[model samples]
Target: MQQLTVKEINTLVNGEVVGEYTGTITGLERIDKAGVGELTFIGNLKFSKKWDTSEASVAIVYEGIKIDPGAGKAFIKVKNPDLAMAQVLEVYLPDSPHFETDIHPTAVIDESARVGKGCRIGANTYVGKGVILGEGVTLYPNVSVFDHTSIGDHTTVWSGTVIRERSEIGKHCIFHANVSIGADGFGYRPSEQGLTKIPHIGHVVIGNHVEIGANSCVDRGKFSATVLGDGCKIDNLVQIGHNSVLGRFCIMAGNSGLAGSVTLGDGVVIGGSASIKDHTTIHSGATVGAGSGVMNDVGPGKTVVGYPACDSRDMLKQWVALRKLGKS
Candidate 1:
């Protein structure tokens, strides 16, 4: 990242400096681990202990937070510091251009397939029979699009990602490297003999603008569609199991695992390494904190954190009391 001055940050994000300060910040990071020349945030007062140790030149903080005067860190006060920081950071990204549209010679496109004009199929990609790919779809090297699958316009599927048969992917959806959509779920039936595999006949249906991260798996349903609603942002290594339905604009962080038949309402967010049980429902705007083990349904707009996932407020209170108990 290029160095940005304090004045440049204020201009980019429309923020004001709370204290008299001027310096060049090289990058953005969290307060607990920011290095020299990096600008970080102090959203939670709990992280105050790490402020003194932070090598950051400046910290973006909200009004009314008291830091140690000895720390000597310049502060940027805003109505919402985090949002301002994010806005300033957005300008540093590279622009994507539209130029080429052509399939590679090595790509094996089935004669029975129906592909839209101007689609680009990369090397070693296999578009199976009866597959319907909309216009401007770009498949990276080695992407396997199975039979009867339908992908909407302008979707980009990265290398090694496999779309199983009969899946329905929406427009502008990006499946990053090694993403596996509409794969068979782990379903078995107990019989008098041995375990019998239950065939998954249902598909995975994704809505528009949904972006799936690298190496993630969204399994095919047993009978009905496993749906990912519009604009759901899933992170790397996340797993959405069979028959699950995620609502619009849901955000799931890395390594979050949702069991089969689970349902998430709109704007739900599951933190990193969180595990949600099968058949449980998460209501709209709910948040599950990092490492949470959710066994029961979550209420709308509530924040849950901890093992067996209790309310975030109750968990924080218990954690504070427990620490004091240990000290006593």
Candidate 2:
């Protein structure tokens, strides 16, 4: 068991300690569930109010909060308790899966592929012709990299991910299980023979530090690449349609989707299950609320809510007015 003193934990987060605690912390847990020898955190007033009832011997609290570290308890105060907790949790993190060998015997690499040094290819993985994998790349079991795809150094692709032909992945990116990159877009037109599907000849370009969750899909474009900029984070079951362009640090929560040709500027956040209309542009720092159906462009730093989304303030006022009418 790894043990850390209250003082040691405080040093890790650069926090101000409230009590002279000499107890050792053995683990971290939720505030309400924490016990003796365990540490917890409070980021808001709701959690801070639980301190008296919580069993934790130590805690990390937001700075400037009115928290009392009763008799035996200690509090480490920081600017952001959530971030500090994350840094502390790293000490308790377990090891991830790794291959015993650099290249597993069951894995297949095409003769024309260029795999850099220190790459770890897990069992049953396939690297197709002209594939380029930079150093320290890890392709977990059952991963499929198609022809001409390039993955940069230190990128880790989890099991069952499929990178179709011509895809480009950048350094230090993580792709969770079952992710589909460079898939055909849903493009069809009415024709004499009913419906004709448009050919998707382009690919996907993901920038450095991007992290895509499990089962997400990034569709290939009709003529150009579908791009995800550096530090973009996509949640599980999200969908990025063909030719969609996302700028740096964009975040799409679970089940959120962008229709074809959508453009999102830096720091845009799409809430869970929200859908952006085709050809729509969301400027930098805008946020779309959960379950919203966006049909028009959103300005920078604006927040939209409701079904057929409008400005958050306007939507709240509308809700209040509706409630008043119901009572009238």
Instruction: Please name the candidate that would achieve the greatest lDDT relative to the true structure.
Output: 2
Instruction: Please write out the lDDT profile of model 1 over residues 178-264, one tens digit for every residue.
Output: 999999988989997889999998999999999999999999999999999999999999999999999999999999999999999
In angstroms, give how far residue 31 of model 1 lies from its true place: 12
Quantify all predictions' global Cα lDDT against the true fold.
0.88, 0.95
User: Ten-residue segment with the worst summed lDDT in candidate 1?
Assistant: 92-101
Candidate 2, pairs of clashing residues: none
**Candidate 1: stretches off by over 4 Å:** 1-101
lDDT of candidate 2 over 2-48, digit per residue (tens): 78898888889999999766778989999889998899998999888
**Which candidate tops TM-score?**
2
